[model samples]
Target: MLVKDMMHPAVCVTPRDTLATAVRKLAHEHIGCLPVCDGMRPVGMLTDRDIAIRATAQGRDSNEVTVREVMSVGALCCSTTDPVEKAAQLMHLSHLRRLIVLDRRAHVIGVISASDINGFLSEPRPFEVVFYKEVLDHLGHTHRSQLMRISMAHGTREEAVRAAILEFEETRRVNHWNALADGYDVVSVRSNS
Candidate 1:
Protein backbone atom coordinates (compact mmCIF):
# COMPACT_ATOMS: atom_id res chain seq x y z
CA MET A 1 0.00 0.00 0.00
CA LEU A 2 1.20 3.52 -0.75
CA VAL A 3 1.64 6.18 1.93
CA LYS A 4 -1.02 8.32 0.29
CA ASP A 5 -3.44 5.43 0.59
CA MET A 6 -3.26 5.50 4.42
CA MET A 7 -1.85 8.83 5.61
CA HIS A 8 -4.06 11.30 7.48
CA PRO A 9 -4.35 14.89 6.35
CA ALA A 10 -1.76 16.70 8.50
CA VAL A 11 -2.60 19.33 11.07
CA CYS A 12 0.51 21.48 11.14
CA VAL A 13 1.98 24.38 13.13
CA THR A 14 3.93 27.41 12.09
CA PRO A 15 7.37 28.38 13.38
CA ARG A 16 5.82 31.51 14.82
CA ASP A 17 3.26 29.49 16.75
CA THR A 18 3.60 29.74 20.53
CA LEU A 19 4.14 26.78 22.83
CA ALA A 20 0.96 27.66 24.71
CA THR A 21 -1.06 27.44 21.51
CA ALA A 22 0.66 24.22 20.54
CA VAL A 23 -0.13 22.64 23.92
CA ARG A 24 -3.78 23.57 23.65
CA LYS A 25 -4.01 22.13 20.15
CA LEU A 26 -2.29 18.93 21.26
CA ALA A 27 -4.70 18.46 24.16
CA HIS A 28 -7.75 19.34 22.12
CA GLU A 29 -6.81 17.09 19.22
CA HIS A 30 -5.60 14.27 21.48
CA ILE A 31 -2.59 13.97 19.24
CA GLY A 32 1.05 13.50 20.22
CA CYS A 33 2.88 15.59 17.59
CA LEU A 34 2.44 18.55 15.27
CA PRO A 35 4.27 19.16 12.06
CA VAL A 36 6.05 22.49 12.10
CA CYS A 37 5.34 23.86 8.66
CA ASP A 38 6.71 26.59 6.45
CA GLY A 39 3.79 27.29 4.16
CA MET A 40 2.84 23.83 2.84
CA ARG A 41 6.19 22.18 3.59
CA PRO A 42 7.11 20.66 6.92
CA VAL A 43 10.27 22.03 8.52
CA GLY A 44 10.19 20.41 11.93
CA MET A 45 8.21 18.31 14.42
CA LEU A 46 6.86 19.31 17.83
CA THR A 47 5.88 16.38 19.98
CA ASP A 48 3.89 16.73 23.19
CA ARG A 49 7.04 15.75 25.01
CA ASP A 50 8.87 18.61 23.33
CA ILE A 51 6.60 21.09 25.07
CA ALA A 52 7.22 19.49 28.46
CA ILE A 53 10.90 18.78 28.02
CA ARG A 54 11.98 21.66 25.81
CA ALA A 55 9.64 24.42 26.92
CA THR A 56 8.11 23.82 30.37
CA ALA A 57 11.33 22.34 31.68
CA GLN A 58 13.47 25.15 30.37
CA GLY A 59 11.90 27.72 32.68
CA ARG A 60 10.92 29.68 29.60
CA ASP A 61 7.58 31.44 29.40
CA SER A 62 5.36 29.21 27.28
CA ASN A 63 3.70 32.24 25.74
CA GLU A 64 7.05 33.45 24.46
CA VAL A 65 8.48 30.21 23.19
CA THR A 66 7.89 29.53 19.51
CA VAL A 67 7.66 26.09 17.98
CA ARG A 68 10.83 26.71 15.98
CA GLU A 69 12.82 27.28 19.16
CA VAL A 70 12.38 23.67 20.32
CA MET A 71 11.04 21.66 17.42
CA SER A 72 12.93 18.64 16.07
CA VAL A 73 13.86 20.08 12.71
CA GLY A 74 14.48 18.32 9.44
CA ALA A 75 11.67 15.84 9.80
CA LEU A 76 11.80 12.48 8.06
CA CYS A 77 9.45 12.44 5.09
CA CYS A 78 8.29 10.13 2.30
CA SER A 79 6.95 10.65 -1.20
CA THR A 80 3.24 9.95 -1.47
CA THR A 81 4.00 7.18 -3.89
CA ASP A 82 6.36 5.32 -1.52
CA PRO A 83 5.29 1.98 -0.11
CA VAL A 84 3.90 1.90 3.41
CA GLU A 85 6.62 -0.54 4.45
CA LYS A 86 9.31 1.98 3.51
CA ALA A 87 7.68 4.55 5.76
CA ALA A 88 7.54 1.96 8.56
CA GLN A 89 11.23 1.27 8.17
CA LEU A 90 11.99 4.98 8.49
CA MET A 91 9.83 5.16 11.61
CA HIS A 92 11.59 2.14 13.11
CA LEU A 93 14.97 3.72 12.51
CA SER A 94 13.96 7.14 13.86
CA HIS A 95 11.89 5.79 16.78
CA LEU A 96 8.93 7.67 15.33
CA ARG A 97 5.33 6.50 14.89
CA ARG A 98 4.38 9.03 12.20
CA LEU A 99 5.90 10.24 8.97
CA ILE A 100 5.22 13.33 6.90
CA VAL A 101 3.98 12.49 3.44
CA LEU A 102 5.05 14.92 0.74
CA ASP A 103 4.15 15.49 -2.87
CA ARG A 104 6.36 16.22 -5.92
CA ARG A 105 6.67 19.86 -4.92
CA ALA A 106 7.98 18.82 -1.49
CA HIS A 107 4.77 20.01 0.04
CA VAL A 108 3.21 18.02 2.86
CA ILE A 109 0.11 16.23 1.74
CA GLY A 110 -0.48 14.24 4.88
CA VAL A 111 1.01 12.17 7.68
CA ILE A 112 0.97 8.41 8.26
CA SER A 113 1.07 6.86 11.71
CA ALA A 114 1.57 3.26 12.80
CA SER A 115 -2.09 3.25 13.74
CA ASP A 116 -2.99 4.27 10.22
CA ILE A 117 -0.87 1.42 8.94
CA ASN A 118 -2.61 -1.00 11.30
CA GLY A 119 -5.99 0.27 10.17
CA PHE A 120 -4.92 -0.59 6.65
CA LEU A 121 -4.59 -4.21 7.67
CA SER A 122 -7.22 -6.75 8.67
CA GLU A 123 -4.50 -9.03 10.00
CA PRO A 124 -1.08 -7.43 10.46
CA ARG A 125 2.05 -9.20 9.33
CA PRO A 126 4.54 -10.46 11.94
CA PHE A 127 7.20 -7.93 11.01
CA GLU A 128 4.65 -5.12 11.03
CA VAL A 129 3.58 -6.07 14.55
CA VAL A 130 7.18 -6.34 15.69
CA PHE A 131 8.09 -3.02 14.13
CA TYR A 132 5.21 -1.32 15.87
CA LYS A 133 6.20 -2.84 19.22
CA GLU A 134 9.80 -1.78 18.80
CA VAL A 135 8.75 1.81 18.09
CA LEU A 136 6.61 1.88 21.23
CA ASP A 137 9.34 0.26 23.30
CA HIS A 138 11.90 2.79 22.14
CA LEU A 139 9.61 5.73 22.91
CA GLY A 140 8.70 4.32 26.33
CA HIS A 141 12.33 3.86 27.25
CA THR A 142 13.18 7.39 26.10
CA HIS A 143 10.47 9.03 28.21
CA ARG A 144 11.25 6.95 31.30
CA SER A 145 14.89 7.89 31.12
CA GLN A 146 14.10 11.61 31.01
CA LEU A 147 14.53 13.47 34.29
CA MET A 148 16.12 10.30 35.64
CA ARG A 149 18.60 12.00 37.96
CA ILE A 150 19.22 15.49 39.28
CA SER A 151 19.97 17.28 42.55
CA MET A 152 18.66 20.53 43.97
CA ALA A 153 18.78 22.10 47.43
CA HIS A 154 15.53 22.82 49.25
CA GLY A 155 14.44 23.82 52.77
CA THR A 156 11.21 21.89 53.43
CA ARG A 157 10.19 18.39 52.32
CA GLU A 158 7.55 19.75 49.95
CA GLU A 159 10.00 22.30 48.69
CA ALA A 160 12.54 19.56 48.12
CA VAL A 161 10.06 17.62 45.98
CA ARG A 162 9.32 20.66 43.90
CA ALA A 163 12.98 21.48 43.56
CA ALA A 164 13.76 17.96 42.46
CA ILE A 165 11.08 18.13 39.81
CA LEU A 166 12.49 21.39 38.51
CA GLU A 167 15.98 19.99 38.61
CA PHE A 168 14.83 17.00 36.56
CA GLU A 169 13.30 19.38 34.07
CA GLU A 170 16.56 21.29 33.77
CA THR A 171 18.50 18.07 33.41
CA ARG A 172 16.22 16.78 30.68
CA ARG A 173 16.72 20.05 28.84
CA VAL A 174 20.48 19.89 28.99
CA ASN A 175 20.76 16.21 28.19
CA HIS A 176 17.98 15.74 25.65
CA TRP A 177 17.58 19.17 24.13
CA ASN A 178 21.09 20.49 24.77
CA ALA A 179 19.60 23.82 25.72
CA LEU A 180 22.25 24.79 28.28
CA ALA A 181 24.97 22.29 27.63
CA ASP A 182 27.41 24.98 26.57
CA GLY A 183 26.91 26.86 29.80
CA TYR A 184 29.16 26.46 32.85
CA ASP A 185 26.16 25.10 34.78
CA VAL A 186 26.53 21.78 33.00
CA VAL A 187 28.21 18.88 34.79
CA SER A 188 28.72 15.65 32.93
CA VAL A 189 27.67 12.46 34.72
CA ARG A 190 28.96 9.06 33.76
CA SER A 191 26.39 6.50 32.70
CA ASN A 192 26.33 3.27 34.72
CA SER A 193 26.20 1.25 31.55
Candidate 2:
Protein backbone atom coordinates (compact mmCIF):
# COMPACT_ATOMS: atom_id res chain seq x y z
CA MET A 1 0.00 0.00 0.00
CA LEU A 2 1.02 3.63 -0.49
CA VAL A 3 0.89 6.65 1.76
CA LYS A 4 -2.20 7.97 -0.01
CA ASP A 5 -3.97 4.73 0.70
CA MET A 6 -3.25 5.05 4.41
CA MET A 7 -3.04 8.77 5.26
CA HIS A 8 -5.97 10.95 6.20
CA PRO A 9 -7.11 14.08 4.35
CA ALA A 10 -5.14 17.22 5.23
CA VAL A 11 -5.84 18.66 8.68
CA CYS A 12 -3.47 21.49 9.41
CA VAL A 13 -2.80 24.65 11.45
CA THR A 14 -1.23 28.00 10.64
CA PRO A 15 2.12 29.39 11.79
CA ARG A 16 0.47 32.31 13.52
CA ASP A 17 -1.86 30.01 15.38
CA THR A 18 -1.20 30.07 19.12
CA LEU A 19 -0.06 26.96 20.92
CA ALA A 20 -3.17 27.34 23.02
CA THR A 21 -5.26 27.41 19.85
CA ALA A 22 -3.53 24.37 18.53
CA VAL A 23 -4.15 22.56 21.81
CA ARG A 24 -7.80 23.47 21.64
CA LYS A 25 -8.01 22.27 18.06
CA LEU A 26 -6.32 19.03 18.93
CA ALA A 27 -8.66 18.43 21.83
CA HIS A 28 -11.80 19.53 20.04
CA GLU A 29 -10.96 17.55 16.93
CA HIS A 30 -9.73 14.59 19.03
CA ILE A 31 -6.41 14.55 17.24
CA GLY A 32 -2.84 14.23 18.56
CA CYS A 33 -1.09 16.46 16.06
CA LEU A 34 -1.56 18.93 13.21
CA PRO A 35 0.61 20.02 10.32
CA VAL A 36 1.47 23.71 10.35
CA CYS A 37 0.51 25.07 6.96
CA ASP A 38 0.82 28.21 4.87
CA GLY A 39 -1.66 28.22 1.99
CA MET A 40 -1.72 24.43 1.62
CA ARG A 41 2.01 24.08 2.10
CA PRO A 42 3.20 22.13 5.17
CA VAL A 43 6.02 23.86 7.01
CA GLY A 44 5.98 21.94 10.27
CA MET A 45 4.03 19.75 12.67
CA LEU A 46 2.84 20.48 16.19
CA THR A 47 2.14 17.52 18.45
CA ASP A 48 0.64 17.33 21.93
CA ARG A 49 4.00 16.27 23.27
CA ASP A 50 5.56 19.40 21.85
CA ILE A 51 3.14 21.54 23.79
CA ALA A 52 3.74 19.52 26.94
CA ILE A 53 7.52 19.62 26.73
CA ARG A 54 8.14 23.09 25.32
CA ALA A 55 5.31 25.04 26.87
CA THR A 56 3.58 23.30 29.76
CA ALA A 57 6.70 21.82 31.30
CA GLN A 58 8.45 25.17 31.15
CA GLY A 59 5.42 26.94 32.62
CA ARG A 60 5.06 29.04 29.47
CA ASP A 61 1.59 30.20 28.67
CA SER A 62 0.43 28.42 25.56
CA ASN A 63 -1.68 31.43 24.59
CA GLU A 64 1.43 33.56 24.43
CA VAL A 65 3.36 31.17 22.18
CA THR A 66 2.89 30.58 18.46
CA VAL A 67 2.96 27.15 16.89
CA ARG A 68 6.16 28.19 15.09
CA GLU A 69 7.84 28.32 18.47
CA VAL A 70 7.34 24.67 19.42
CA MET A 71 6.46 22.92 16.19
CA SER A 72 8.86 20.41 14.66
CA VAL A 73 10.17 22.44 11.72
CA GLY A 74 10.66 20.79 8.34
CA ALA A 75 9.22 17.55 9.64
CA LEU A 76 10.15 14.33 7.88
CA CYS A 77 7.46 13.63 5.33
CA CYS A 78 6.70 11.20 2.52
CA SER A 79 4.87 11.39 -0.81
CA THR A 80 1.39 9.96 -1.17
CA THR A 81 2.63 7.41 -3.65
CA ASP A 82 5.53 6.21 -1.56
CA PRO A 83 5.45 2.61 -0.38
CA VAL A 84 3.93 2.07 3.06
CA GLU A 85 6.94 0.05 4.19
CA LYS A 86 9.28 2.91 3.34
CA ALA A 87 7.16 5.33 5.33
CA ALA A 88 7.12 2.93 8.28
CA GLN A 89 10.87 2.62 8.13
CA LEU A 90 11.29 6.37 8.05
CA MET A 91 8.98 6.74 11.02
CA HIS A 92 10.94 4.15 12.97
CA LEU A 93 14.33 5.65 12.16
CA SER A 94 13.17 9.16 12.91
CA HIS A 95 11.56 8.01 16.16
CA LEU A 96 8.31 9.53 15.00
CA ARG A 97 5.10 7.61 15.30
CA ARG A 98 3.38 9.85 12.78
CA LEU A 99 4.50 11.04 9.33
CA ILE A 100 3.01 13.80 7.26
CA VAL A 101 1.86 12.47 3.92
CA LEU A 102 2.49 14.97 1.11
CA ASP A 103 1.18 15.41 -2.42
CA ARG A 104 2.92 16.02 -5.73
CA ARG A 105 3.24 19.73 -5.05
CA ALA A 106 4.49 18.97 -1.54
CA HIS A 107 1.23 19.99 0.05
CA VAL A 108 -0.07 18.15 3.05
CA ILE A 109 -2.35 15.28 2.09
CA GLY A 110 -2.58 13.00 5.09
CA VAL A 111 -0.81 11.52 8.07
CA ILE A 112 0.35 7.93 8.67
CA SER A 113 1.75 6.29 11.73
CA ALA A 114 2.82 2.99 13.30
CA SER A 115 -0.80 2.32 14.20
CA ASP A 116 -1.72 2.48 10.51
CA ILE A 117 0.78 -0.25 9.81
CA ASN A 118 -0.63 -2.31 12.67
CA GLY A 119 -4.14 -1.85 11.33
CA PHE A 120 -3.04 -2.98 7.89
CA LEU A 121 -1.31 -5.95 9.36
CA SER A 122 -4.49 -6.94 11.20
CA GLU A 123 -6.51 -7.42 8.04
CA PRO A 124 -7.52 -11.03 7.41
CA ARG A 125 -6.51 -13.13 4.42
CA PRO A 126 -3.68 -12.13 2.03
CA PHE A 127 -1.77 -9.86 4.43
CA GLU A 128 0.60 -11.07 7.07
CA VAL A 129 -0.62 -11.24 10.65
CA VAL A 130 1.42 -8.96 12.83
CA PHE A 131 -0.64 -8.45 15.97
CA TYR A 132 -4.14 -9.73 15.39
CA LYS A 133 -4.52 -12.39 18.03
CA GLU A 134 -2.71 -10.31 20.58
CA VAL A 135 -5.12 -7.47 20.00
CA LEU A 136 -8.27 -9.57 20.32
CA ASP A 137 -7.04 -11.36 23.39
CA HIS A 138 -6.35 -8.09 25.13
CA LEU A 139 -9.42 -5.99 24.32
CA GLY A 140 -11.96 -8.69 25.16
CA HIS A 141 -15.65 -8.44 24.25
CA THR A 142 -17.40 -5.22 25.29
CA HIS A 143 -14.89 -2.67 23.96
CA ARG A 144 -14.29 -4.72 20.84
CA SER A 145 -18.02 -4.81 20.16
CA GLN A 146 -18.23 -1.05 20.32
CA LEU A 147 -15.34 -0.61 17.93
CA MET A 148 -16.87 -3.10 15.53
CA ARG A 149 -20.11 -1.19 15.48
CA ILE A 150 -18.35 2.08 14.70
CA SER A 151 -16.22 0.59 11.96
CA MET A 152 -19.12 -1.18 10.34
CA ALA A 153 -21.32 1.88 10.50
CA HIS A 154 -18.66 3.94 8.75
CA GLY A 155 -17.44 1.18 6.43
CA THR A 156 -13.82 2.04 7.26
CA ARG A 157 -11.66 -1.06 7.26
CA GLU A 158 -7.90 -0.80 7.11
CA GLU A 159 -6.71 2.78 7.23
CA ALA A 160 -9.76 4.15 8.95
CA VAL A 161 -9.65 1.36 11.50
CA ARG A 162 -6.06 2.33 12.27
CA ALA A 163 -7.07 5.93 12.61
CA ALA A 164 -9.72 4.92 15.09
CA ILE A 165 -7.19 2.97 17.09
CA LEU A 166 -4.94 6.00 17.17
CA GLU A 167 -7.86 8.08 18.42
CA PHE A 168 -8.56 5.51 21.08
CA GLU A 169 -4.93 5.66 22.12
CA GLU A 170 -5.09 9.43 22.53
CA THR A 171 -8.22 9.06 24.62
CA ARG A 172 -6.32 6.67 26.87
CA ARG A 173 -8.37 3.62 26.06
CA VAL A 174 -6.49 1.16 28.23
CA ASN A 175 -3.39 0.82 26.06
CA HIS A 176 -2.29 1.03 22.44
CA TRP A 177 -2.16 -2.76 22.12
CA ASN A 178 -5.63 -3.08 23.55
CA ALA A 179 -6.84 -0.42 21.15
CA LEU A 180 -5.22 -2.27 18.26
CA ALA A 181 -6.93 -5.42 19.37
CA ASP A 182 -10.29 -3.73 19.61
CA GLY A 183 -9.60 -2.40 16.12
CA TYR A 184 -9.64 -5.96 14.79
CA ASP A 185 -13.23 -6.30 15.90
CA VAL A 186 -14.03 -3.24 13.83
CA VAL A 187 -12.04 -4.53 10.87
CA SER A 188 -13.93 -7.78 10.87
CA VAL A 189 -17.28 -6.03 10.98
CA ARG A 190 -16.28 -3.41 8.43
CA SER A 191 -15.50 -6.09 5.87
CA ASN A 192 -19.15 -7.03 5.85
CA SER A 193 -20.32 -3.44 5.49
Candidate 3:
Protein backbone atom coordinates (compact mmCIF):
# COMPACT_ATOMS: atom_id res chain seq x y z
CA MET A 1 0.00 0.00 0.00
CA LEU A 2 1.06 3.59 -0.64
CA VAL A 3 0.72 6.55 1.66
CA LYS A 4 -1.72 8.27 -0.65
CA ASP A 5 -3.92 5.23 -0.57
CA MET A 6 -4.27 5.31 3.20
CA MET A 7 -3.74 8.97 4.10
CA HIS A 8 -6.66 11.10 5.23
CA PRO A 9 -7.25 14.79 4.65
CA ALA A 10 -4.90 16.79 6.89
CA VAL A 11 -6.37 19.03 9.55
CA CYS A 12 -3.90 21.86 9.79
CA VAL A 13 -3.27 24.83 12.09
CA THR A 14 -1.30 28.01 11.64
CA PRO A 15 1.83 28.87 13.59
CA ARG A 16 0.22 31.94 15.09
CA ASP A 17 -2.76 30.05 16.38
CA THR A 18 -3.10 29.85 20.14
CA LEU A 19 -2.55 26.59 21.97
CA ALA A 20 -6.10 26.75 23.32
CA THR A 21 -7.48 26.91 19.78
CA ALA A 22 -5.26 24.11 18.55
CA VAL A 23 -6.23 21.95 21.49
CA ARG A 24 -9.87 22.41 20.60
CA LYS A 25 -9.27 21.26 17.04
CA LEU A 26 -7.32 18.27 18.27
CA ALA A 27 -10.09 17.29 20.65
CA HIS A 28 -12.78 17.83 18.05
CA GLU A 29 -10.92 15.73 15.51
CA HIS A 30 -9.92 13.13 18.10
CA ILE A 31 -6.36 13.35 16.81
CA GLY A 32 -3.04 13.69 18.55
CA CYS A 33 -1.32 16.03 16.11
CA LEU A 34 -1.98 18.72 13.57
CA PRO A 35 0.20 19.77 10.67
CA VAL A 36 1.34 23.34 11.24
CA CYS A 37 1.17 24.97 7.87
CA ASP A 38 2.12 28.24 6.25
CA GLY A 39 -0.31 28.59 3.39
CA MET A 40 -0.29 25.13 1.82
CA ARG A 41 3.17 24.04 2.96
CA PRO A 42 3.76 22.21 6.18
CA VAL A 43 6.24 24.02 8.43
CA GLY A 44 5.95 22.08 11.65
CA MET A 45 3.84 19.72 13.70
CA LEU A 46 1.89 20.42 16.86
CA THR A 47 1.30 17.31 18.93
CA ASP A 48 -0.60 16.72 22.15
CA ARG A 49 2.67 15.76 23.77
CA ASP A 50 4.14 19.09 22.76
CA ILE A 51 1.32 20.95 24.41
CA ALA A 52 1.55 19.00 27.63
CA ILE A 53 5.31 19.22 27.97
CA ARG A 54 6.06 22.64 26.59
CA ALA A 55 3.07 24.55 27.82
CA THR A 56 1.25 22.75 30.59
CA ALA A 57 4.35 21.50 32.32
CA GLN A 58 5.95 24.91 32.07
CA GLY A 59 2.80 26.47 33.55
CA ARG A 60 2.29 28.72 30.58
CA ASP A 61 -1.12 30.05 29.72
CA SER A 62 -2.41 28.07 26.80
CA ASN A 63 -4.45 31.01 25.60
CA GLU A 64 -1.37 33.20 25.46
CA VAL A 65 1.04 30.65 24.03
CA THR A 66 1.18 30.33 20.26
CA VAL A 67 1.56 27.11 18.36
CA ARG A 68 4.93 28.30 17.04
CA GLU A 69 6.14 28.60 20.63
CA VAL A 70 5.63 24.96 21.48
CA MET A 71 5.16 23.14 18.20
CA SER A 72 7.89 20.80 17.02
CA VAL A 73 9.76 22.42 14.21
CA GLY A 74 10.62 20.60 10.98
CA ALA A 75 7.79 18.13 10.63
CA LEU A 76 8.87 14.86 9.04
CA CYS A 77 7.14 14.34 5.76
CA CYS A 78 6.75 11.52 3.23
CA SER A 79 5.70 11.74 -0.34
CA THR A 80 2.14 10.66 -1.01
CA THR A 81 3.40 8.09 -3.52
CA ASP A 82 5.86 6.52 -1.11
CA PRO A 83 5.33 2.93 -0.03
CA VAL A 84 3.72 2.24 3.34
CA GLU A 85 6.86 0.42 4.47
CA LYS A 86 8.82 3.64 4.08
CA ALA A 87 6.28 5.46 6.20
CA ALA A 88 6.43 2.75 8.83
CA GLN A 89 10.21 2.92 8.96
CA LEU A 90 10.15 6.69 9.32
CA MET A 91 7.64 6.57 12.14
CA HIS A 92 9.51 3.78 13.92
CA LEU A 93 12.79 5.63 13.77
CA SER A 94 11.38 9.04 14.70
CA HIS A 95 9.10 7.74 17.44
CA LEU A 96 6.24 9.53 15.77
CA ARG A 97 2.76 8.10 15.48
CA ARG A 98 1.97 10.09 12.34
CA LEU A 99 3.69 11.82 9.45
CA ILE A 100 2.68 14.57 7.10
CA VAL A 101 2.03 13.36 3.57
CA LEU A 102 3.08 15.80 0.91
CA ASP A 103 2.21 16.08 -2.74
CA ARG A 104 4.61 16.53 -5.69
CA ARG A 105 4.48 20.26 -5.20
CA ALA A 106 5.54 19.98 -1.57
CA HIS A 107 2.09 20.81 -0.33
CA VAL A 108 0.41 19.36 2.72
CA ILE A 109 -1.96 16.88 1.13
CA GLY A 110 -2.86 14.64 4.03
CA VAL A 111 -1.59 12.71 7.03
CA ILE A 112 -0.54 9.06 7.39
CA SER A 113 -0.81 7.83 10.96
CA ALA A 114 0.43 4.57 12.40
CA SER A 115 -3.12 3.25 12.24
CA ASP A 116 -3.14 3.91 8.53
CA ILE A 117 -0.33 1.42 7.91
CA ASN A 118 -1.85 -1.99 7.35
CA GLY A 119 -0.31 -4.63 9.59
CA PHE A 120 2.89 -2.66 9.80
CA LEU A 121 3.36 -3.44 13.46
CA SER A 122 1.07 -6.40 13.89
CA GLU A 123 4.01 -8.71 14.66
CA PRO A 124 6.38 -8.34 17.57
CA ARG A 125 9.71 -6.51 17.22
CA PRO A 126 12.71 -5.91 19.44
CA PHE A 127 13.33 -2.26 20.24
CA GLU A 128 16.55 -0.66 21.42
CA VAL A 129 16.30 2.01 24.11
CA VAL A 130 19.07 4.32 25.20
CA PHE A 131 18.97 6.31 28.41
CA TYR A 132 21.11 9.43 28.78
CA LYS A 133 21.99 10.39 32.30
CA GLU A 134 23.79 13.11 34.20
CA VAL A 135 25.56 12.07 37.36
CA LEU A 136 27.52 14.17 39.84
CA ASP A 137 31.26 13.78 39.83
CA HIS A 138 33.37 12.78 42.84
CA LEU A 139 34.13 16.47 43.47
CA GLY A 140 30.39 17.19 43.58
CA HIS A 141 31.17 20.26 41.55
CA THR A 142 30.95 18.81 38.07
CA HIS A 143 28.33 16.79 36.28
CA ARG A 144 29.30 13.69 34.35
CA SER A 145 27.34 12.11 31.59
CA GLN A 146 26.51 8.45 31.15
CA LEU A 147 24.29 6.37 28.95
CA MET A 148 22.87 2.86 28.88
CA ARG A 149 21.17 1.01 26.07
CA ILE A 150 18.75 -1.85 26.50
CA SER A 151 16.77 -4.06 24.20
CA MET A 152 13.12 -4.83 24.92
CA ALA A 153 10.40 -6.80 23.24
CA HIS A 154 6.98 -5.64 24.36
CA GLY A 155 3.62 -6.29 22.80
CA THR A 156 2.83 -2.62 22.45
CA ARG A 157 4.72 0.67 22.17
CA GLU A 158 3.35 1.96 25.47
CA GLU A 159 4.45 -1.20 27.20
CA ALA A 160 7.91 -0.95 25.68
CA VAL A 161 8.26 2.66 26.82
CA ARG A 162 7.24 1.98 30.41
CA ALA A 163 9.32 -1.19 30.57
CA ALA A 164 12.39 0.62 29.34
CA ILE A 165 12.13 3.21 32.12
CA LEU A 166 11.53 0.62 34.79
CA GLU A 167 14.36 -1.59 33.61
CA PHE A 168 16.74 1.34 33.41
CA GLU A 169 15.97 2.54 36.91
CA GLU A 170 16.27 -0.91 38.44
CA THR A 171 19.46 -1.84 36.59
CA ARG A 172 21.15 1.53 37.05
CA ARG A 173 20.07 1.85 40.70
CA VAL A 174 18.50 5.22 40.09
CA ASN A 175 15.69 6.64 42.17
CA HIS A 176 13.72 8.27 39.42
CA TRP A 177 13.69 8.01 35.63
CA ASN A 178 12.12 11.29 34.76
CA ALA A 179 14.15 12.02 31.67
CA LEU A 180 11.69 10.18 29.50
CA ALA A 181 8.62 11.87 30.91
CA ASP A 182 8.37 13.90 27.72
CA GLY A 183 9.42 11.04 25.44
CA TYR A 184 12.31 8.95 24.17
CA ASP A 185 13.46 7.49 20.89
CA VAL A 186 13.73 3.78 20.16
CA VAL A 187 15.05 1.85 17.21
CA SER A 188 13.74 -1.49 16.06
CA VAL A 189 16.66 -3.80 16.62
CA ARG A 190 14.95 -6.61 14.73
CA SER A 191 11.52 -7.14 13.29
CA ASN A 192 9.82 -10.35 12.19
CA SER A 193 6.73 -8.58 11.00
The ten-residue window of minimal lDDT in model 1 covers 126-135
State how far residue 92 of model 3 sits from its true place (Å): 1.7
Residue 106, candidate 3: C-alpha displacement in angstroms: 0.6
Reference-based lDDT, residue 187, model 1 = 28
Candidate 1 vs candidate 3: the TM-score winner is 3
- The models' CA-based lDDT, in order, is 0.67, 0.70, 0.80
lDDT of 3: 0.80
TM-score of 1: 0.60
TM-score of each: 0.60, 0.62, 0.61
Candidate 1, pairs of clashing residues: none
lDDT of 2 by residue, 23-137 (tens): 9889988888899999888899998899999889999988899999999898888898865656776787888999888889987878887887877644543222123333234
The reply for model 1, stretches above 4 Å from the true place, is: 119-193
Provide C-alpha RMSD values for all models, in order: 20.2, 12.7, 13.4
- Once fitted onto the true fold, the runs of candidate 3 whose alpha carbons sit more than 4 angstroms away are 118-193
Worst 10 residues of 3 by lDDT: 176-185
